[model samples]
Target: MGRGARETVLGTLGKATILQIPPELQDLTRRFGEAVWKRDTEDPQRKLVLLKYLDGNYTNYMQERTRFHKSSFSLEILNTSRQERQLYEFIVSKGPEEKVWQIQLEVYEPVSDPSIQILGWALVNDSCTITLNCTAERGDNVSYSWGSWDTSTSGLCSHNGSLLYLSYPLQNTSIACACTASNPISSRVVTFNSSECSYEQRGKFPRTEHLVLLVVVPIVAVIIITGVFTAAHLAMPIAKQEHLPLAEDSAVHTIYSQVQRVESPDKEPTTVYASVMMPTA
Candidate 1:
């Protein structure tokens, strides 16, 4: 039989090739065969050899270690897009299985790098606030610890979900922040200095001044205007010379009385006629 045809038959039977053929397949079935000869040999759990041909410069152990670290195997097909179930069924229907067995191959792709971010930072009024942020590959959990440069204090304050914020009063002096994030396969450290200080004013000037001026300016203006009006009303005016016009009758009486008091005795009484003169051109 042709190689491809033979492979197809073997694969259908679940044996596949000479490398995976059991010793019992070598024995021929006969009616006269003794019990010992016919005894079924336990198929040593079929060992799938993952052959890796490294370059000339690479060592055997290194290749093995790399394969182990990456968790790669011919049977262990990586579901890159995680569409393994669909791909498995499609490949099974294509051509002969023996042709597929002739190809012994696998590819190793490097894993993604780790991601680190500063999610948030907290500042305590009297103490120090320590924080940490790190994310690993999906399905991987990160282990971490916190420590300061000062030997006086160290411990796991608390771990809330993905955030780590702590206020330590004991080690309030000049200090540094350091932490190690790790998984089963890898680990890394992140640190920062306490000397980096920053400042901000949180209160609002517009709202505060708006409220104060709203209450004070009107009150002061009203008091000033009231005091000015009050002083003007209370002030006493000093007296000065003011003339009054006399009435015609009163003027005549005053003249007669003056004449009666006259001291001329030897003179005869004389009649006097008063004439009013008109003003003319």
Candidate 2:
């Protein structure tokens, strides 16, 4: 057959010419015949030779001029797609004894590169919740895994599936987080730095609130204290001046009352009695 025709047939069979036959098709080799044969190269136009076992010798059935007669033949096909059945037919007894063989093949592709995304704003200080997402572009029978490497301590943490929750007090240095996409055929991984992630404030109070506490509160207190001290200082001189005259007036009134009492004693002589004591040498 032409190269195009062979490729068309192989494509219809859903098989690649370069790869090995899948394990599900291994039974077909025994069912067809003991000897299994397949193409070793990627050339689509390569001849497909079938060997027939008869009369204690193997004969090439594709050769029209061969002297050996054909009874049973075996052929092996490789690199078939999964969950598909293909049919093969050949003439055995020339007229009505033609038989057909059916085989099922299963093939899987390698896992594609895993994609990693931060679910929300990630922070190192444990102020906010952080999550990670992992996905694969294409694969068959695939699974996901997550891991992180502590750059400071060379420690490793592993988890399964597409989602991972991160906790606080992360490593001091940058952390390498990875997502791996795996399948029976192959696996792929992707990595990113935790330090590159963005962080957001989740608390009701923000850094600005802290700044207000640190700066504005002390300033307001100082202003209030200064105003109180200024008001007290401004009132002290007024209070002293208003009370000084009252004290002097009370002293003068006491002396005047004593002199008047001695002068007017209801006509009785209010005399001042004095006793003189002599000092003897």
Candidate 3:
């Protein structure tokens, strides 16, 4: 940390009421700090127990030690509190100009699982882009990781990380996503289902656009059908037309009979007359 940041942290630590630190903390520091470098210190359980007083993760004892002075040690409580977690610093030095072996300590609680949320989404053409988040109820010293969206893992729908990139035909289908929040002490997982997200949005057009199409398409069809019939009627050829003649001034006209043909050449020709109307004017 920088000097300014360290001083700022120290300034904050100074504001809290000075509660007397437990004397046993120094003894605990001494137990581990003094045994930094030695030979034949093979009592694994004893050393682990001693280390646990500061950090609980030291389950087994391993001799990864170097030259440490058991005589010169100073235990400094960098920051502390009675009811809450605290930070400690154990500094072991041989002399003013010598190397320093410092161990900073802090208490860690089990991480709580973060909640997942669909941050936002966009639909463009045949593809959809969706962003996700798992910051809600964030855990201490947390990390982020996302699960796969495939069938082998029994996951739902496409793509990686906190963003889901899905293809077309998303109707009748869904996407299941998993986001994990983890720390050294614990890990948590949160899942999200995009089925409902893509449920109402079945087709390319939304419900409102579909409604508009429903109204517009039929009107356009009716206009096209009407135009087709009109063009056909206009293109057809009209046959020659004739109307029967009407008598003038309500006068009756002469009637005509069909001509009779002679059976032999000697037979006389038969005369036939057709009714003819003459104009009064």
The most accurate candidate by lDDT is: 2
Stretches of candidate 1 off by over 4 Å are 1-125, 128-131, 136-139, 156-162, 168-173, 196-281
In candidate 3, which residue pairs clash?
A: 256-273
lDDT of 3 by residue, 2-91 (tens): 111111012122123221223343454454433221111244333222122222222213223111222333222233322223232222
Compute the lDDT of residue 216 as modeled in candidate 2: 91
User: TM-score of each candidate?
Assistant: 0.28, 0.39, 0.33
* Sort by lDDT, top down from the best: 2, 3, 1
Residue 141 error, candidate 1, Å: 3.9
Candidate 2 structure lDDT: 0.50
Residue-wise C-alpha lDDT for candidate 1, range 68-127, written one tens digit per residue: 211111222323221111111001111223111222221222223434454444445645
- The CA lDDT at 219 in model 3 is 97
In model 2, pairs of residues that clash are none
Q: What's the alpha carbon RMSD for model 2?
A: 22.9
Candidate 3, residue 62: Cα displacement in angstroms equals 28
**Candidate 1's TM-score:** 0.28
Ranking by TM-score: 2, 3, 1
Cα lDDT of all candidates, in order?
0.35, 0.50, 0.43
Task: Give candidate 3's TM-score.
Answer: 0.33
